[model samples]
Every structure is written in structure tokens, then in C-alpha cells.
Target chain A: MGMLIIIDQPPYGTWAGREALDMAFALAAFDQPTSLLFTGAGVNWLRKAQDTADIEQKSLEKNLAAAPIFGIEAILADRTACQRYNLNSEAMIDGVQLTNASADLLGQYSQTAFAG
Target chain B: MNQLHTLHILNKTPDHPRFSECLGTLGPDDAVALTENGVLGLVASKALGLVQTYALESDLSARGLSDDNLEAATIDYSELVNLTLQAERVISW
Candidate 1:
């Protein structure tokens, strides 16, 4: 069974979300099956276009795009959250699946993690 | 009577010392939900792996955060209430 890493915070405001991503990648690198689930403001990381130059922070899109190479294949977002923020597949970086946010959906995982 | 699971509600950032102190007290059968600013702790520590963790949807929106990047399940107020009802005890930190 794979581990689910749920991120709910936006990037750049604090290093927490980005750090969480790092942790996920670390787990994946160690050969642990890992999946990323984004909802709420965390979806912002998947925006197709982001301007981080003003903040002097490197864009997270490139790292996110490279997630597959690190063995993270299943990336999902909450459908309601995506709709609330007006984010669709076209507006997001490649490889994100939108899913219905239901208790049953979450129950599918044997272990769950939260890093906002 | 069978003992019910403890529901721990954390409402502070992970850096807060209480966050870890509070987490240290949880048992394997307990459940945890992060609300208010406590949601920040999700990334603050790997201790969350000790128990199932959940995040509040409204709080995340208020903070301009989406679950898109979060590692916690997003639940609404109704779900929160349900969780509370299912637990044998509730504690907030």
C-alpha cells in the first residue's frame, strides 16, 4: 500500500508546504510508495503559470513536474477545491487528477499524512 | 464499557512547542484533526504518521490555502462534527 501525503497550504508564504513536498520526495526516493493529494490553497502549486521572480523563490512547478521521475505517479486534487479556485486540468501542470472529496475516498488509504 | 478513541484537535503552528508536547500524548488508536493555524503542523513534523490526520476545509480557505498541496484529508464542519461524535473523548491544543 502507498502512503498519501496531503498538502493544504500554499507555497512561498512559509516553507512548510515546500518542506512537505521535500519529505514526500524523500520518502519516494527511499522506495516507499507515495502519492500526493492537494486540496484547498495547496492547489496553487499546480498553476500552469506562476511568477516567483518577485519573491526571488524558484518556481515549484519544475520540481512538481519532476515528481514522476522520483516515483510519485499518483497526484490528486479535491474536485470541489479545484472548482472553488477555478482550477481545471488545463490550468494546472501536467499529471494531476481531480477527485470527489468523500470519506470513502480517503478511507482507501491504509495510512494518511498531513503536511500543510 | 469499551474505551472510545481520543480525538485530538490541534490549532497551532507546528513550531509551537505545545504541538509536539500534545502529539506526544496520543495513542495509536487516537484520531487527530488540525484546524485553525494548527494545519501548518502537517509539514512541521513526521510525528503525524503516528495517527490519522485531517484538515479543516473552511480554515484552509480562510488562510488562502488549498488542499492541492496538503498531505491531510480535507473535511467540512459537518464532517468535523461527525468525527467528534464518533470519538470517545475530545481535546484541543
Candidate 2:
């Protein structure tokens, strides 16, 4: 298993931002140690409430809630992104650790994959 | 070649600066995987020229990109997976 990093989010709109997390889960299924970093509008994915019934998409909240079970311990959220979006940490998905997008966090991985 | 050790996976369109910017940084030995929106580069190979490109077969077909348009580089899913294994590192954008 290799380092699997995902950053799936756009500046404004749709579900493309969730692709990174989906890929991360797929990678985890292969026994890879996965990490996720949400930035820009991607941070909205972590917000506590999400319902896909309207668009006929599967519940996104259901998918994100399983990260811990998949062995993904690191879920980094950009502090600036949260501020820009006016999203509070308390409203984020459970088990996700929020933090700034620091060099140390980014450099820790060998490869960085963006899903935007 | 030692330069081929790094495989850069690009998922944006040719219009994306990341495509040009990433290409400029690539050594002659690097291999590129055109997936998602990056397949647009294949459509304009005449101007972009040939620089060792490969399109994810599944993605290209899913997006309705035919072989005729993929004059630059085209490969199947197995080839894409194999390239990743051959690479010392895989960077996706």
C-alpha cells in the first residue's frame, strides 16, 4: 500500500469535490493508508448536513461517515477554507480533524492528489 | 530511463495552466496519463505536439473521445495501472 492523498472540491458547486474522498476509500480497500485534505469549497463536504435525495445521488454523508472504518485517520480541513465558507468546525463530519493547510501537513505525504 | 520514474497523472483540460506548467517541469523521462479533462490535450496534439502522453481508455471513451482524436497518446486501463506500478511515484492533478 502506498500513500493515498485526495483533495476533491471546487471553488463553488456540485459533487466533484467528493471524488477525492471516494478514491481514497477505494485505495483504502486495497489496504493503503489514506489521508484526505479538504480545501477551498471542498470543505463543504465535511459540513455535518448533506442530503442527496433531491438530486437522486446517494447520501454523501453516508459515504463520508465511513472514513474511520476504512482506516483513514487523517482528515485535514483547511482553516482558511472554513473561514471563507463561514462553516464551523462543530458542524463537520464526525472523526475528521480540522487544521490549517500547512507545509508540514502537505509535505508529510510522498504524493499529493487533487480531485478538483 | 531514470527520468521515467515519476508518472504525472493529469485530470484537467489542455486549457488548464496546470497542464502546461506541469509539462514544463517534466523531464524527458516522465510519462503522463491523460484522464478526466486532460484528454482535451489529445484533441489539440498538433499544437501541443507529442510529449509522451497516455489517455485513460475508460475515461476517454466515457467522455466520448475517440481514437482518431487521441493521436498523442492512448492506452488502456491495464496499461495505466502498469505504468503506475513502474513509476517510483505517481502525482495526480
Candidate 3:
């Protein structure tokens, strides 16, 4: 069965967003079909210009870019969330699909997980 | 069958309660890795008593910590990826 993880928190300020991504990778490592959907402030994780050096935190963007290597093929962002944050596709990492938050889209998965 | 293992990635400093709390949940066969500020946990001379204990090399250097002073093995990004793949579940604290 496929698992969809929905993340709604921004990265770095709190550990929730990073922890959620870790869960997705962990599930994928166990041979479970896993996907991630970024919404709300979570969409910031996809931005390519994140500079964590001043904050002394490791870059979450680097980890997000490595998602594909962990067997997580589906990385998505909520369309409205991008507009809400004024983020364009060019500003994000390559290959993160953008889609609306629709029930039909969510229903495609066997189980849904969230870290807020 | 081989038992499933859980990998605990601690990204917080040792001063945080979750740092110690996470250790109690580890199985004898589980593994732990300290990254980011969590690498500070190794400063204390306590034995983790797990199958393995690791500290991300990049994080250690970023924080100006010397891997030579740590009790855990130093790992790179590739090893971090491998550790996650080797575990059935991962908890970041």
C-alpha cells in the first residue's frame, strides 16, 4: 500500500517538518510506497535559496533534493500554498509537482500521514 | 527473519530532554546518529550501548567539533543515507 505524508509546517523553526520528511524516508526504506505533499508553510521546504548557515542549522533543502534517492518518487506541493507564499516553480527545486488540494487526489493513496 | 530496526536521529542538543528520552526507546539492536546540534550529546562521556552510534561528519565540522573527541563513529552524507535505508523506521528528535 502507498502512504502519503502531508506536511504543513515550515522548516528550521521547528523540527516537525524535518521529522515528517524523515518518516517518509523511513517508510520508503522499509519498502513501503511513500509520497510527500507539502502544504501551508511546508511549501517553503521546496525553495532552492534557503540559507541556513547564519542560523547554524543544516539545510533542509539539501535533504529535500535527496528525496528521490530514498525511493520517494512523488513529491508534491499544494498549488494555493505556492501562491500564498508567492513562490514560483522556478524558485523551487526541480521535479516537485504542483497540484491543488483535492479530495480525489488524496483518495489515490492507501493511507495518509501528517506531521504538523 | 531478521528483526526490524529503528534509527534515531537526534538533531537537538544534549540539553534538550528529548535527547535523553529518545535513548530509552531504542531497542538493543537499534542505531542512533547525532547530527546538527545533537552532536553535543557525545560531549558527555556516556556509553550509548547500542548496536551503533554515529555523528555526521559535516555537522561536526560545521559546529567546529572534532570527530576525534567524539565517542561515535563519524559518517558522511552517503552513510547517513545508507543508515536510513538500513532501518525500518526513523525518529528525529
Candidate whose lDDT is highest:
3
Better of 2 and 3 by lDDT: 3
Write down the TM-score of every candidate. Answer: 0.55, 0.50, 0.55
> Model 3: residues >4 Å from true position, as ranges?
B1-93
Off by over 4 Å in 1: B1-93
Clashing residue pairs in candidate 3 are none
- B20, model 2: CA deviation in Å? 25
User: Per-residue lDDT tens digits of candidate 2, residues A8-30?
Assistant: 45321345556667778888888
Q: Individual DockQ of the candidates?
A: 0.03, 0.02, 0.02
lDDT of each: 0.75, 0.65, 0.76
Ten-residue segment with the worst summed lDDT in candidate 1 chain B?
B59-68
Order the numbered candidates by TM-score, best leading: 3, 1, 2
Ranking by lDDT: 3, 1, 2
Supply the DockQ value of model 2.
0.02
Question: On a 0 to 100 scale, what is the lDDT of residue B40 in model 3?
Answer: 50
**What's the distance in Å from true for residue A90, model 3?**
1.2
Task: Tell me how much of the true interface, by contacts, candidate 1 captures.
Answer: 0.00
> Native contacts recovered, in order, as a fraction for each?
0.00, 0.00, 0.00
